[model samples]
Target: MTRRTVVADTRSFRSDIQGLRALAVGLVILAHAGFRTASGGFIGVDVFFVISGFLIIGLLLREAGESGRISILDFYARRARRVIPAATIVLVATAVASAYVLPLVRGAEVIKDSVWAAFFAANIRFSLVETDYFSQGEPPSPVQHYWSLSVEEQFYIVIPLLLLAVAVVVRRRAGEAAEADRVRVLRRTVFVVLAAVTLSSLAWSIHVTATSPTGAYFSTAARAWELGIGGLAATLVWGRAPRLGRWATEAVLAVGLALIAFATLRFDAQTAVPGSAALVPVLGSALMLAAGSTTGASSTYLFRLFSIAPARVVGDWSYSLYLWHFPVLRLCEEYWEEPRLSKPHLAVALVLIFALSAASYHLVEQPFRKGVRWRPRLRAITLYPVSLAMVVVTAVGAHAWVDGQIAALEDNPGIAVSDYGRDGLSKDPTVALVEASVLAAQDDRPVPGGLEPALGSVRESVAPLGDCDYRTGTRKLCAFGDPDAERTIALMGDSHARHWSPAIDAIGREHGYRVYVFVYSGCPAITFTRLTDGGRPWTECADFKEWALGQVRELHPDLVVLANNAYQSAAMKKRQVGALRDQLELLRPLAGKVAMIGDSPKLPKAPGTCISERDVDLGDCLQEPETGPTRIQGQFRQTVEDLGMTWVDARRWFCAEDRCPAVIGNVVPLRDREHVTVEYSTLLADPIAAALGIAEG
Candidate 1:
């Protein structure tokens, strides 16, 4: 292959830009490390978006100006060199680490995520999965941070072609005109496009953020305006020299820094983001960029400080730092079982992050960008195919492994369902505890075949079919057990209610009852409105619940079972209790017997991981259950009694003496933190049936 020198463009280079990069990465690091003061530090991503727009668009404009046409191949090749190598390294490392440290189920998810990240489509994958960015209970994926990189990659793919199309249009319109006239037309076209994109996307951002903040955070359309703002600035100042005086430059820089600081300190998880709030950091970044472009501003003290070696060094490693930090933090939390890092732990994590980032930047990023000489075609042929092959192999292997485990478990049906031999209303916790101890004793023995991975296939065994689960405005009713039975039983609520499907289905099948399930993921069968974890009004959830209530009334089931994971706003005890009471009152008229099923005890982490990891002690995995009735349970129980209904506490099945064990009878009791594993749920059929005052068939 022939070599070509892609020399630096000194005129476009701004030393102070590196300082902005440092500041942005620093804020993100602080936020992820759990710094209370830097609540809005997530805004650093908006700043980076603006900087990326300014720099990339400026490069495109320069290429068009000097060469009289832009080279799409060359642009993409540069992008590949800058992004692919280090990212691939991180993805591979993360996959290997995840498989070793996390549970097989979670490890499988990370493997899939790594594959998506490798293709620069992680944002699409995350959006499809509906991964909530602000969820505290869910385990953080090692590659979750790749969503931002995916957005940037998607932008790079489109923007170049967009600019080239504009150039073609300008050339056609200015046929036989002077080169200067053609340039003027092109600049005007660029400005119009950027301004239009900025306004439209900003409007979309505000609307989406208000309606579905989780979706808004990941959607490219909602985020395009942040990048477009930078593109607009670049277009307006194309081929021009800054004319700001020394004091004016200082004032602008000071104001820009102040705006960034204000956002970093003031914004928290509850604050609506990437909407109007994002303007603070976006405009601040643009102001700094404008100030940096001034020719003599380098002499100013503020500018000089920003251009210092340390800031530039940090800026150079910013991309790698951003990639490494979150994974390291997540791994630390996973291993140590401590989500909140102490000062000493935070310091150690930072040191490790910086070291990893520095090595990655020097070894993978810089060498690929500066030393490698492969043409775009060669790189695409070699790099993409290899990366794709790695992804396919890993994903296939993971799926097969999990599938094999599930198949093995299917062969041994007795392991999951054999322990439910008890009869009547038994209050003895030792019955379940003794059974679980017998199961635990089997943990040390090697079986004829390897042990079946229960947690990995927990959801698939009992979850309502995906297409039948009601979401959004749609209403879906899944019927289990004897459809023509005289006695009808209805299961209603969110995922917490759905987790009980296995148990209810077993009871219905055995006792000649038809079971109807009306459940969604986040929606509870309650009267009061609730917001999503991201702080957006859960309007779809409200609509679904209304539809479900109507279905329950129409069906008029002999018995109605109400359950939900009421963990949100634990501090707001009174509100939660009142909501449950209102819900019970509504359900009373719908069924002959209304029963309030108290939530199962929540574990600190997924029981599967705790059981899988040899280093984790079984005792540490157990959680101290509530000593007294939860406010919601107590209030709902009182209301049920007053209405002459029933209250069944399910915690007795999972917990003994106010302490919940992670595993029972070779079964991982909880799937995630709160939902019971399907195997465990199936075992609870007898107890649940007795709670509803049903006689055995």
Candidate 2:
């Protein structure tokens, strides 16, 4: 193994370059911590990309003509020593901390992040993770910044080896011509990679801007061109420049610095394509490097600025600072339930980042880098597994614990469904698809208005003044719908069917009809069980629907009622109606009456909290409404109506004249993006009662 040492000519290295690194990384730190002024600070990463390209290319050129072997083991060993120690420490600690802090679903998400970080596949991870980037006012996980490191390291793995191979081939040919050919080959590779990367970035940026801008901002694919641009500079121009007059070089150097400063101040998160925006700093760095390496006077001013001692120190610590800042920011954000972070919080983040990075650099990074001083086998063997085990154990254990609770909730979806982020989302004013649909039902436009929200209802359907367990799959538990019960009525369906209950329950008490409801979460009162994942038959859903219908007939329900959102699609809606019809056909003979409460507006996409629901960041929802749900609702409505299901149209009911409020008349309409809030759902009681020919709830 060979150790690559800094040469005696190290003084020739520009100290201002390190300062430049400091400035870039500092911008990233501030930007991520939610400093509004640092909105353009994300361009710092682009600056770093250029710097990396310059430095790596310079290092490769230093050994370009050397005859001795380039040790792959040593190269990898240095990389591992520099990166794994601090990264693993953070990963292990963060994993354990997250197990306790995050909820079941969020905990699972963090574990996936941990696995990606451990393997240096964070770039790949970021590409797949669907989350907002600029609005990252939410707490980011510790592993989030690892994506940048992954890209650098992955590039390092290839670039050095490729350069080494080029050197070897050039030596075998043993001529200036052959060396030139070798350089050409290397340049060709760079050009090809750059072209591909740029094109891909352009395409992705356009797509994401049009479709999912937030995702595009965070995705590595959309950002790769920044790095590729630097790589192109390295291959095409870095070492081959001709000497220029000193004053001329200084002028060029000054211009470069001016460009970087200008870009730092002007570029921001919302800047689109960023293709040309990023070029300003990268090209600036290239010019500065060119001026210094050449005998040109144009670079003198820039070189002098980068040669300062303080600047060098900052550059030395820049990587460590970058690593430490995001976690500190995230901690504060999580603690505060922050949407917009305060300056004091950002300052605290900076303080924490500096303190930790300094401590970590001296204690962990320095010692490990001294490969000759330390016992390698001891450190590698003891540190590696312990660090890895910590991450794995913490992640897996936390996942298992969270999953167990989730599984329990899944098994008992009745009361447990209310526990799933309902309170958090409801208290927040953000509009999820469910909330949007609920509000849409209140619109002034003429909806085929039959149902309305029954506010201030305290009605219960369980009666004979006693409790009964109808939760069993096969057994039917009879509880009178009201203490003042007379004629029996039955309500049967999935959650959609269950939603009609609030009003029906009030109406049942008022009209002397005992409305007994048999309900399931997603397995609406439909007969079809074919809509399932994993290619498995859900015979249970089919049976539950069938048995509930049978019970309605045997119990001699006076008014047989069946209902669901008819908007599911003609084929799918027909299946749902067929199930409803089956129940109606059976009950009509026994009850001598039947009514199918119409379907509510359905959303196309599953409502997920687009923004943090707990923090109550309704600004984004109010600012840019999500259309996935409304579109799905249109499809669902068309399908259901096509099936000829007697349905109440909720489109006009939920919306205002044009804009629908997420919360209507002080009611939060959704638990998540899909399901209605129990409190909000209860509001529907009155409208249902009025439509059922009973007293207004």
Candidate 3:
């Protein structure tokens, strides 16, 4: 295709759309910056999806309408020019900043995330990792915002091919003389296709949001409907939307703005989102776009306001602003060790964000878009191969570097067992002795060679045995520690219980007892009903708990060890305590002895990410362990004591008299915010066995 043929649609400025961009970006910034009123400002991303669909689909339809065919190469080249340059600059810069500001272990993960973002596959990577977008304990990735961009890029890739196919079929049927009829047929066909996709995607969004809200948030399938809604609008009424009277335009604009405002102010992280709730913002945005398109120059005051220079200027910088805000906010949070910013600090950060956005928009984004000629021949000859090579090289290099670091750590035996206090183990172990050893080894500096090597090895040490580990639905029994042994000790509960397996299994092996691992992800061992994060009944957990109770009775295990991370809302504390009482009462009659381990200290942040060798002091990363018994722990102890069962308070092993150190005896204590590292868990074997009345071998 010639340059003239490909460039059939000239770019025209739309002040209203630009204003919408500004509003969307502003809401997102406010929301991310911890403004209480903008809790639902995250919906701004949904607004962007609609706007993108409208603009991109409009261009393709216009091109096909004029030339009777779409230039695939030219379309891709235009996308590359518009998206890649600024994204690359931001990705590289974020990677460099992460290495300096973040812990080495976390920095390695960010590098991987940056590589995924560079290839516009960050959404897929995040989904694979099951990263919780709303999690508070885990530090957010600097490039987490790239997930939406990835979804949009994926849409761009698919939509053009679909439009081209529709155009081909329309032309083949109608012939050259009936070009107008062919274009009309293509429009109708496109509208029908978009409508179907919209409904299908909406259904999927609702279903997925109900079943798995976190997954739904990052899912392309769940988000596609929003874009399809915009595509439908473009196909049906690009330039020919019916003109509306001033009164009607004003009403539409008023209602649209109100809906968006309600959603922005009312919705929060706990709100079910990307489902029916998302329709508030999506439909509101569509209404605003429709009204803006139909309103005349002398129409409504709202239309005039949106067309003003200030909104347009912000709109011009909106893309860069959105790109810059999250990373800047994340950096600020990392430095301060706080999620919320003070007013003065927030104001300064916003100023910095705007300055950086302006520089990126002018120096990187606008320059590349204008200079890069999107001619079909040039793009096919140069851009595609070069872009693909950059993506491949970045991803491969990052993966290789992380792998090498992990491998070096794994090969060094000294690093694995360093400062473990193995010599301190005694026949009669106590929490006080464990604390003494840890406190004795405590140092201001981070572990030697940083914590990445230890953090990387953590998973391997605690990972459930092969295929025997139960991940979903019901429980699967995984046996360890001399399976042929007559005396069986059962370890039960969710991942909190699973974290203690390294020590428990070691104890079982030494004692000539078989250890049966029966744990599920996120499912606690409780008698009362519980809900998943998505607000559905945790049926699998209930089912597994019931089944395990029966199995324990049948097997007549010599000992049953129970544990759970019972940190929950104050409202549920009473019910959770009651449930613990009920579970303990039931277990008392089934096993020879039932022991309940108290929950570990829930750290303010992931220890791996919080502790670094570069820091002058540990700072707020070291928190004082709660002096009094936790409400749940107190309840558990009371319930177990009432049932005449064993109750082990293991908190002293994790925290000392004043503070809980992130690293104890050259070992990072936590794999994440809540789970203890296997190396540390192994250190607790003697103390735990002592608590269980198990004598040393």
Candidate 4:
């Protein structure tokens, strides 16, 4: 193997950049720790992206300038050694710890997440999960923060190949040219490529952020421009960095810091990320990096402040700190009932994070990083495969543990139908089964066997919408149950309405009514909608609704049923009521009849999660009718009834004696906190049929 040398020695370390790392990690930790003021602390990852691009690109350019070629093998070797060691340890540890701490269902999810994180595809996995409507309400994975690392690792791969491509093109164009000429051409070509990536990705990021913010948030394509901007800065500063005066440097640093501070303070989770808003922090980080690379900048007070010993120390441990803090905070938050940790709990988490990070830095990160330095052989690159294998083995072990638990539970005796009859709970079998389960729960009896969909897979038992359930404005007509029937029934709403599809389809089949289903994620079918949850114009949902309503009109459905989440917005109360009225009035002319399916009760804890716990009191999974959200839903029911449309009270299907159980008729009711599972919904077909006055076949 050919040997190559780095252009700069280790002493060229920029304490200012190190301080910047400290700042970035600090912001992330503060945000995760629930510091309300630092709601936009997520910009810290943007800072890190810029820093990584500047340092890595600058190093590669210097090596290319010196040797007339860049060594892809050596570059990858360093990256593998620097990142893979600490990352592997964290991934494996988080997976093992999750299996012990989380319930079987959630723990299995974490194990799968760990595998994705280990292979640096966690962002893709998470984006897929987020796009799945059923997984919307699931808790964040312990290794969720690895998504950023995955982005960086992906950058590491693409950048080297990109630079090599630039080198190849420069050599072909400037054949037999002097080394200086070749270097100059390489630099210019690299700059153009970097600029194009930055601009094109920025435009795409803005578009995606508007249309699909969750997808944009985790997308490498959307985030690449941030790193590209940093690369552009590095390209400009290489071999010809400005020698700015102290005052100029201070002014630049001050402006950069101000921009970052403004974004950190003013932005919140609702901010459209990696979009136009992201320019604030990305540019801020780029400016600071550019200024710091100048000759006289280090003498500036602002520079010295960032170069302080404490900041430098924090920066040294920043990588390990970033890796450990999220899982530590997430697992700790799991034990706490509140959405955000209390100050005392946060303090404890910080202590644990710092301690674990310090240990990881000294014990794992330092050893591997230094080992690579002492043994700079091409064989060190093999660490990539080895590290991945270690993580995979750990994930496999965790999966085995989860599968073992499922098999054991499967062997236990199941709750018999005889129990329902012996209990004499209700004449209706479904109602009776639910009542019996509730009684068994109240008595603190062991979790019975033969639970439908099983707790381990219950989270995934959502009503299957095939390809028709749109997450965006795009519409696809999906018909069920006697698609050729003359009498058509239109079922329309957001995911809340979707949960009732199984029962409605079953009823439609029995009654010879073709069901046309139109369900969009987070989109309420009611007219007069104006804004999305992020306060942007809800053009997509509005267009979808118009298109769906037009289709319903064309079909001339016999009955049009509209349903959505019943959880009331204190502010949108009047608007929601008015919208429903307008929706009914509009649909009255489009169909023979209009009906509204009342919202089902929302559980405090997700039934899938609640039932997974050892000896969990199933009664705790039940919700009362008078809960705030349920009361609000009831108010909406009254409004619907007052509008002279048949209102199917769906609460009656799930609730018995004013109490709604999470599991009914041996099936998990809600997949998450609100949407009912397909199995439970199927069991409600009889009640739904009676409610709609559709005589069974």
Candidate 5:
């Protein structure tokens, strides 16, 4: 097995390739830049994959034709030099910024991802962490775009070695036409892999669009097919294929650009992934690629347009722009405490990215890749380790910086969690908070007659009847069943109400029970009779109950329901305790057969914290709080014992012992921020309904 070296050569990067790069990167830039015309602009990444496959394979073909060997190490090392340095710069830079920007609970997760990206597992991490793209108001991670780099890296790892093995076989088998035969085998392999991956990706993409939209959008399994399409384009470079004619190419590029423009303007993450809609731009790109300027036809208008010197410059610097813009825009958003990008912000981002990508491409990528002043040894051995070191060092430094920032935030001259209520607002929003656990167990504070002091409403103590529900916003109420139907069971509470509603609704549909949800975002099932600790009437809460009472009086539902966390956050003060008692007393007989839905065991403050820190299998976030209300269980029992209501304790649903898994019944226990995601809620529908006696009815 004598080793042969393929002398690296320069086949001019066709104008069409440059134009395609311009198109792909432009789509991505416009979409990411919040350009309204390029909503589905991410399809550009698929185009980039095709362009990469074409370029890399073209290089491989050129080598095989010239020298009988494919140098796997040389190919990989070149890739390392070109992609690693700039990427590391972006990663390190973003990691540092992330420390100051993201919340501490989330900051550490981003730092962990930074390490994963440095190691080339970003695609996998994102697949697990960020499957949903439609969740509103979620923050962006600093290294979000690295998912594409992961795809490219994963491709490189497999393609080079496969190409090498194919080359080896051609070398041994082909007596005279080894070069041609070798290229054929490699081409076939690439085509086959692309075809397979394309099919799988398309299938997964379809599944995600319909089933799990979030996971479908982010996971590599659902996205790899786009890159495979590019790989298909790459395999076509060597054949004497009939060109699409200049007119066709131009029209396709124009159409592709148009489709992309329309998609950006018309579509959003809510529109779905890669379904029939994505084809408009992806195929359009393929057409422009086929209609090269080399074919002198009038149809090549867009090709010629993209081939122009300035457009090519934009294409050249696109990578850096893609990298720098997001970070700059994000950092600015964080600094200003704004969430969306503004026009001025976009202008700044574009300018910064242009400068950075230009400097990086010329000073770093070009200088390192082109050996005008350097040798193979210099390209492979000199630059690669330095780039790796920079990535690792920067990542660690950013982690430390983030740690310091969080510490600083804790000691800030301003506000903290205890300072504000559950909402990310400056004021409290609860009518009355009763810590049953503190009242029952801890000597720290008293219960219903001696609870803490936090008011619910800010203004208009006696608010209007219409704008009332157990929540924060204008439409603060989320109803589960018929808003106006007879034979009703009012499901009143927070997410627990949400969880129980589906089951109740299903049972309602089956057993002639109309379930009406008078649920707040996180507030529990207690009545609204007391003032907030701040001494304001809990108007919003009281209004919600009043509205329910009105509905009850009007329709004469068989039962009026109430449910809540009964979360006994320890250490209450005075009036809130008495208020709690009054609240329960007021609510106990809202219906002829009133019920209090008990709390499931609340997980501890954090995931995996109790086990790792407490050295016990206390379940995820679910801990037997030594100081607080006994989660949802004991509170329901207490309220029933005191107020004489039917107690429906759902505690048995989660607890098996002193240990209960955060997720029970093979479902995610909580969706996000404490409420169960729809999946788990749907799963637990039956038990909640039966427990509420709706199933028997």
Candidate 6:
């Protein structure tokens, strides 16, 4: 009822926690800034999770202890005031900046990402997309960092209710017990619940990280344990400090800092994270908090060091810094068209990030969080829905504007569409015509008006291989073309091979042949021990390849088609060429004929994005062909040809006179930096069939 017990700050503020916040944000910034030593700096987010769990649950527990009940309204009001305002500003600002600075295709993506972030569902959006946070080729969404905040918000929503439920159940069970005993029982019950959650989530995190690393990285279920560990620590050291000696407390603090440092320096993009591996930083953070909660721990040198003026200042602004850095750095990279920012650009970006964080902290975060003196007490809580509505409106506006721009580009009179008569080098007239159109468009002409799979939707224009079983050793095929056709052909490889389905399906239908698809996203059909993006051995790929080959042998299809991106074979040492030859030899005995589609020319940028950004002079998006197939690709080609298997020279179809245009026959060739769009792949059917010497129906 009084000021002391009305709010949840029943415990005194710990400046060391502020220092930990500074540390967490620093690690994340350094990692994202491309500091090689801080490669594992992503663990900083795990540290933050631990800190949030400790602070939030501690607040809830303290309120229940002092006031005999928890005010869910007050808890949510504090969260809305402290979090929503600053987050909304970042979301809106990032959306506006993305529309102006990013390519039109990426702009659309950012808008969608912003909408998800506004609703506090950014993690869900990212998980659904299977966004590999560590991916080298794809640009991170501007709002990607919001995923961590989303996780925390979700935890906040549930933790209060959970604590309240525990308080209610304990009071009911202890109706005649003293107040002291009632509070004690409630805390103990909550501790058990937190422990159960921690262990179960940790187990799930390890399993999911192994099976589906990308999704696991963004999953709340996989990450809840980190926060639970923090909550458990808070519950253990709630009212009284740990009774350890000063020396013991200092030792705990030192070990905690060491663990954090080790993870920051030793971890890299290849580490499967927020799993068992994440325990280092999560536990380290919890230990640091727990150590400070010990008697006389605040006087320790480690605590004093963390509480220093500079560290505390940075920590105070840490939230704004985290929100602003990712979008600023990402957009800078997009502007410069460099995967890594140059020194000057990097320096400029740092300046801008700090300046913005400081301004937002003072002008937006502090003003709103502290509340206006004249405003009604409950008015601030309305910010939750208001901020969400503002962000959604911004996203909707951005989406419509992008669509309008694409439509306008499509209406340009200079654009050409001749119904794409097939004629050129391939026996298939359509393939030849498409190639000729591509070559003609190179170094000239604006993007054609009637671009297939309009630029706005091109990024999602991936071939549909959703029904195919990507992991199993068993033959689970997604059939295409005439299913009842007498003749049969099987397509097998990685995503690159999968993209060829549209074209393959067309060829199969024309020639009265049935098509069976067997493909996985990152798994190559090659027989080498492949490392996943996380640097772990990919045994599933090997298993699938073996089973697919065995099935091919049993069925002995009329034709077997194979292709894979060069990245799959990048890890092969001296055995790349040998591996291909061996794979070919195995296939020769099983299939009537074997053909390998050479990996497509690697584009410098995403074609849809390039076209969207340079529609006025589409020639700007033309790629000057590289020397030839990469070393791995060349080796695969030579071995396939040497083994007498048909090797399709795909470059001729995408490039001419050393110039490869982003679009051919009014079609965007690729959905992203790699992987052909289904529309363009469908156009390549005749060329592929001609190369394989397959007769027309």
RMSD of each: 4.5, 15.6, 4.7, 3.4, 16.3, 3.7
The TM-score leader among the candidates is 4
On residues 464-574, what C-alpha lDDT tens digit does candidate 1 reach at each position? 544566754445666787777988999888888988988888989989999988887766777766775446677777887787788888999999998877644643344
| Cα lDDT listed for each candidate | 0.74, 0.56, 0.74, 0.79, 0.54, 0.80
**TM-score for candidate 5:** 0.59
- Cα deviation at 287, candidate 3, in Å, is 1.1
**Rank list by TM-score:** 4, 6, 1, 3, 5, 2
The residue-by-residue lDDT of candidate 2 on 1-697, one tens digit each, is 0013221113244455676787778778767766667667777877887777666554554455333235565456556676777887777666665655554334456677887877777767765543445432234555687777777776666667766675565556555566556555545654565567656765665555443444445556656555555555555553355567887777887787788777767767556534445568767766665555565532465566665777666677777777777766665665565655677866776777788888877787777777565446444445546656777777788777655543342221111113234553333222233343343333321111111121111111111112332333546455544745768778776666666666566667666777677765456655566443223355556667667767776778766666554434344654654554554445557664565654443332111222112222222233222354455445544544565443444444344333443444334344333345455545555555554545442
Q: What's the TM for model 1?
A: 0.86
Cα error, residue 551 of model 2, in Å, equals: 42
**In candidate 4, where is summed lDDT lowest over 10 consecutive residues?**
1-10
lDDT of 3 by residue, 346-379 (tens): 8888999999999998887776666635434466
For all predicted structures, in order, the TM-scores are: 0.86, 0.57, 0.86, 0.92, 0.59, 0.90
Error of 3 at 192 (Å): 2.5
lDDT of 6 by residue, 1-697 (tens): 0011111222666888888889999999999999999999989899889988888888888887766678998887777777888899999999988987888899999999999999899999998877889877678998999999998888778889888888777767888888778778878898998898889999999887876788889989999999999889889888666678888989999999999999999989878887788999988998999988877777799999998988888888998999999999999998887789999999999999999999999988888766474144377678878998999888888888878877777765332334333333555454455456555565466676778888888988878765675653455666688889988899988888988988899998988888888787777666665675456667777777777777787778899998877753345645556766777787788888899998877776777888778334666777764443455678788888788779887867676666677777677788887678889898788767878899541
Q: Write the per-residue lDDT of candidate 5 for residues 1-697, one digit (tens) a residue.
A: 0011111232334544555576677777777666656766777776676556556665665565556578877777667656776777787777776765654434555667777777777777776654344333345666777777777777677666765666666666665665556557656755675577678777877665554444555566666665556446545654544456555555656776676566556766556665545555556555444444234433366656766887667677667766676677666766665666677766776777778878977776666556455446445645556756776787677767654543342221211234224443223111101111211122221111110110101001111223444343354443335554556676666656655565566656656666666665434445434443223354655666566556655544567566565443332222334444565566544565666666544544432212112122222244443324463345457746687666775554444344444323223334332344444445555655666666631
lDDT of 1: 0.74
Residues forming the 10-long window of minimal summed lDDT in candidate 2 = 449-458
- Which candidate ranks first by lDDT, i.e. highest? 6
Clashes found in each candidate (C-alpha, N, C closer than 3 A): 1, 44, 0, 0, 34, 5
